[model samples]
Target: MLRRLELLKELLLLIPLGKVTTYSSLASLLGTHPRAVGAMLARNEDLVVYPCHRVVMSDGRLGGYALGKEFKRRLLELEGVKFCGPERVCKESVVDLKELLS
Candidate 1:
């Protein structure tokens, strides 16, 4: 794996199985920029193992996925983490990551 992706793997493992995380969150934890996380995910090769679906927008927007937004939604749907409330905020807990936490 590339250096960035290797770090991304470790960061991904920090995400809970049934919860959704964000690119920004992962980037912060990895001590990189949010765009860097997005770039790394854009190149993700093993979807079934890494479960990239567990990553989404911070506001529960579902954002973009390697395959497509529909894929992202479908993936999360399978994980049982639904968006709720007026804002459609996800009920699943997201680890609040800081830019310098790493």
Candidate 2:
């Protein structure tokens, strides 16, 4: 479990400056659950290095952040993550985990 969490953090660090990914995507790629990903992220101590804010819900919702939703939204915005509406990120902006891992 600890190893997986470490790998998850490492994977999260790969999220590019302007891209985002869903929690479900990460969980699938990591062979874990979305809630576990969220739990690990919630306890992550290195916010700047991990870039956990780039993760969202599978449905494109901006999911919770250790810092708060607005802060997460602002960070994503600063990184040029596009939104589909007021609260969801555009589907096109989602990062492909397979491509990233490969």
The top-ranked prediction according to lDDT is 2
Query: What's each prediction's TM-score?
Result: 0.78, 0.94
lDDT of 2 at 7: 92
Model 1 per-residue lDDT at 40: 81
State each model's C-alpha RMSD to the native.
Answer: 3.5, 1.0
> In model 1, which regions exceed 4 Å deviation?
85-93, 97-102
Kindly list the per-residue Cα lDDT of model 1 for residues 1-102, writing each as its tens digit: 377788787667666766767877787667778777877887778877787777777777766678887767666667676767423337454555442244
- Residue lDDT tens for model 2, 15-74: 888899888888998898999999999998999888999999988999999888999999
Q: Give the CA lDDT, 0 to 100, for residue 98 in model 1.
A: 49
Candidate 2 at 37: error in angstroms? Answer: 0.7
In model 1, state the lDDT of residue 15. Answer: 69
Give candidate 2 misplaced runs (Cα > 4 Å).
none
Q: Which pairs of residues collide in candidate 2? A: none
Error of 1 at 83 (Å): 1.3
